[model samples]
Target chain A: MTIAMTTSPEALTACCTPTGEPAMSEETASSLAAQFKAIADPNRLRMVSIISSSENAEACVCDITEPLNLGQSTVSHHLKILVDAGVLTREKRGVWAYYSLVPGALDSLAGALTGRS
Target chain B: MTIAMTTSPEALTACCTPTGEPAMSEETASSLAAQFKAIADPNRLRMVSIISSSENAEACVCDITEPLNLGQSTVSHHLKILVDAGVLTREKRGVWAYYSLVPGALDSLAGALTGRS
Candidate 1:
């Protein structure tokens, strides 16, 4: 909330000379922020754990509720956040929905953090 | 807020067995969640990028405020969160506090996410 109006990127680069160069463009920063925020909650982390470790690396909402003891609706909300953030993918099969990790998404994010992306 | 009371780990393991085994224990999940929460903001991500990309991989609060267009106090607050989460280490140099990444912290976190930890 304390984010003030940004000066141009050029202005920024000109002003800050303590480094060889700036990295992490504003666009990339915003993108990774959304991705990290998607999985920052305890329940969400637990969900990812359970699913990633589950059979076929996929899980149903019913399976999700037990470990975290969360309601289906609440779990759905968290899952939606992950899906929206591109962390997990959701597929509907009959009445139940299954969630799985988007391939290489987490690894790609990890690479970004280590500046190896 | 959706996090409910956890069942014993054994009960959880017994109930959800669609896989060879469980991964990412509650304690690890909680710890990683806190760490992810610490860097989930755009400004915070930008700060990390700035510092990691900077000279000697260290930066002062004064340098942080300009690029992110944030106030020094607000930047300090974010820095404290990263420091508290063990993402960054702070050093006092005269009147200024210098912040640098904890070596391998980001990589270790990345490895944990990819199950390479």
Candidate 2:
């Protein structure tokens, strides 16, 4: 695989270049597509939404699962997808993995979709 | 089969309600997921980016294929996905199908991803 994301700011530096307007490059298209694919799943989308609007804008896997009315494993699986997509970052405190929105992840994605800087 | 989309304004009316940050509901998650799914494909993503940045914000299938170096059938398939995702609106003028970005489609998607109004 080409790895999940660019993993560096330099990757996206050209993303917003060309000013005013430009066609999305192949790299940009693939990168943004991967991120969007992460949110493309209903389960992952639900999890990210819950986490984004949660208290402190972070949520433990346990807290996220209950309202979802889904099995623990399924929720975890979905969480993995969001984390892979770079939309959510995971921090393990003790036995729990707490997920929080990666700062600017949504804005970057929104920018990509809107062709904004 | 719940049809591809909600197909009603009432469906998305609740999309932006519950302001000041709130957990995304199941309906909201699914609807947004469906739209995201449309942009999830690499081919489709390339096509949308090309078409979105094209002259007049619209492009015929013929105009889209050459730059991407992809075959006509592949481009058409990608276009179908974007159309199904509600990102591109199609207008058949003579023997060609012309596609234009839906006025608020990108904004609506950006709003959903950003949780913005």
Candidate 3:
């Protein structure tokens, strides 16, 4: 998946350098772009909002599909894209999968964008 | 163009409520996605980094194209997208257009993503 091409969470976390601080290396820009691309879709952004605001900041696919008005398969696809980008983590609970925001992932991206590190 | 559909900077600034705080409304999600879509390209992200790190936190298109290895037209297109998204402000200086990061724009986006007010 495209996730393999993204910067590791460790690299991303350490990369709190703001856009105003320095010129971004091609590698860093590519990695950041991959993460942004994950959330660039309207459906995925809504899914992130819904999943993030859910109980424990996590939710099952069933919990999101209805509010998003997207079918289960579509929601699942978006979830996979997010997960692959390291923005969300997936855990297996019997027959269903639960997804939760990865701690610090969003913060790292924010820091990079805002130069708030 | 598409910028007309985006949420106003005022709305985005007041939207530091964070993703975990509540489910984002469709209007909010769409606006955020439009902003993300603007920077989702690697070339654009690099251009932003270069421009933001330049003198006075701004740069002329000529200053960025060579480092970015992109033609002036391509660089201008990306800059226009960012300006339209309100992430960057454009000013005419003589015959050159200077682009600078809009104050607090990235911070607002970061705040929304990271749930930091």
Best by TM-score: 1
lDDT for each residue of candidate 2 in B13-99, tens digit (9 for 90 to 100): 423233244457778778889999998877777777877887678877766776777898988888888888888999975456778
Top candidate when judged by DockQ against the true structure: 1
Q: For model 3, name the residue pairs that clash.
A: A18-A115
| Candidate 2, A7-109: lDDT as tens digits | 3555434232332444567888888889999988777887788777776788777667777788989888888888888899999754567799999999998
| Best model per lDDT | 1
Worst lDDT 10-window in candidate 2 chain A: A12-21
Ranking 1 against 3 by DockQ, winner: 1
Error of 2 at B107 (Å): 0.7
CA lDDT of A64 in candidate 1? 85
Against the true two-chain complex, what DockQ does each candidate achieve?
Answer: 0.29, 0.22, 0.23
Q: With candidate 3 superimposed using the best TM-score fit, by how many Å does residue B75's alpha carbon deviate from the native?
A: 0.7
lDDT of each: 0.82, 0.77, 0.79
The CAPRI classification for model 3 reads as acceptable
Off by over 4 Å in 1: A1-17, B1-17
Candidate 1 lDDT tens digits, B1-117: 654333545534443445545545688888998999998888889889889988788987877887678898899999999999999999975456789999989988888778787
Off by over 4 Å in 2: A1-22, B1-22
